[model samples]
Target: MLHAFLAAAIPNPGPEAPPGLGDLTNTILAWIKWGCLVSGVAGLMICGGMMILGRRNRNQLAIEGVSSTVWVFGGLALVATAAGLVSVVV
Candidate 1:
């Protein structure tokens, strides 16, 4: 994807644009694409971790530890899903 964009991005240097000039918009778009890719991967990992964590015995562990782990891991998974969706949209 980046390769195709870069291929076409070769500037037509003239009075308007200097030699070797490239579009800033493409740079910004590339950053956004990279960020979204990272977000999706991170979300996937979080969901995987959540599955492992959900299988663990919470109550059988300790009162405080169980409660906190449940809330934290659950919340993290939710946030990860949301981020992944947002990345897809943007």
Candidate 2:
């Protein structure tokens, strides 16, 4: 059948890092992940300060701070689940 023939034409070897670059790739990924964590924490702290400072008269700043908080959390969530998501897709 055409379906079987097509399937046989393609190979699925699963995901893999290049032979010599695995260690370097892993190290880079780890560094990126660490940076994400550090930035997320810093973002939260900055947002907190914004909210506190804007609570007095800068209502617009407070709103902006709250809005950005959601984005920061969303980014953190994505980073946290990236590995699992990649596995599921691959």
Candidate 3:
């Protein structure tokens, strides 16, 4: 049949990774993970500072700081689960 001929014409080479590419990718991923952690911590600290400064009178800053905490935590959660998520999808 035409379907069989077409299937035969197309060869399926599943998942070919170049040599050393995996190692390079892993190194990059590690760097990114560390960067994410550092940034997340810095973001939390900045948010805390904002809340403290705003507590005196500027309620808006305090509210903004509180809301920003959620975003920081969300980013941390995503970073923490990134590997697992990739594995699940792949």
Candidate 4:
């Protein structure tokens, strides 16, 4: 009886099976990946501008710009690796 229940609960993923929830999840993840990439590029541009503007002043704006740039890149890397991370966990 337990084996029958388990088999019923986990259906085999074959070609005949219609699209599953995993398909929707993959679509959403793809959109999120693109969004992250665009945002990271925008952040880099803004930070570069800040760094340039700070060059003429005696403030620490350049340092802030560098830190923000690093954070944006890190976020991009995380988003890019999400698939591999999910695979590892699951």
Candidate 5:
């Protein structure tokens, strides 16, 4: 179904609407976007350093922390995506 729509309509990824605190969805989307980005970056650093840092501490603990960060970031991303989907449908 989605593939058909994309095929029928000419894709115009024009200028994106400016962000504002006009609605809950918009606010949540912004939060998710930023949160995911920050957490993703932090995850990279933590995971990269785990090789060295884990030797001094518990490897499992560090890995668990990174995994948690990934889950949080992923959840935030899901929220943003769901909001966007609702907006489009409406």
Candidate 6:
């Protein structure tokens, strides 16, 4: 019968699926951590290079570079704190 065929074709999902939002939250947090790490490293490298170049040229650009580096570090710290908060809350 059509009813029997349809029922047989549907696969049963036992314990394979996630129980709730925990798995999703952890996965998202992991992605955010990696993204922030990579970007932070790249930003630091670029700013460091700029700082070195500015110093060599004896120009005011070095100050700007330092400020930019500070901002990058601050942003990284904020992201890290946010991720930790999410883990604790969720």
What are the TM-scores, per candidate, against the unseen true structure? 0.39, 0.85, 0.78, 0.69, 0.37, 0.63
Taking all chains together, the TM-score of candidate 1 against the true structure is 0.39
The residue pairs found clashing in candidate 3 are none
In model 2, which runs have C-alpha deviations exceeding 4 angstroms?
A: none
Model 1 scores what on Cα lDDT? 0.59
Q: How would you encode candidate 1's per-residue C-alpha lDDT over 1-90 as one tens digit per residue?
A: 998899799865433434555576567667766776676567556555555555657533344443455555665466557647765665
Error of 3 at 28 (Å): 0.6
Candidate 6 accuracy as TM-score? 0.63
User: How high a TM-score does candidate 2 get?
Assistant: 0.85
lDDT per model vs. reference: 0.59, 0.94, 0.92, 0.82, 0.68, 0.83
Error of 2 at 21 (Å): 1.4
List, residue by residue over 1-90, the lDDT tens digit for candidate 6. 999999999986543435787789788879988999899999999888878989966667777878899889998998879846765665
Q: How well is each residue in 7-70 modelled by candidate 4, as lDDT tens digits?
A: 9999776433256877887788788888889998899999998898778673588778877888
RMSD of each: 13.1, 1.8, 3.9, 5.5, 8.2, 10.8
Which is better, 2 or 5, measured by TM-score? 2
Better of 2 and 6 by lDDT: 2
Give the CA lDDT, 0 to 100, for residue 85 in model 3. 94
Task: Report the number of clashing residue pairs per model.
Answer: 0, 0, 0, 0, 0, 0
Candidate 2 worst ten-residue window by lDDT: 10-19
Off by over 4 Å in 5: 1-32, 69-73, 85-90
- Using TM-score as the yardstick, the better of models 1 and 6 is 6
- Which 10-residue window of candidate 6 scores lowest in summed lDDT? 12-21
Pairs that collide in candidate 4 are none
- Residue 79 shift from truth in candidate 4, angstroms: 0.7
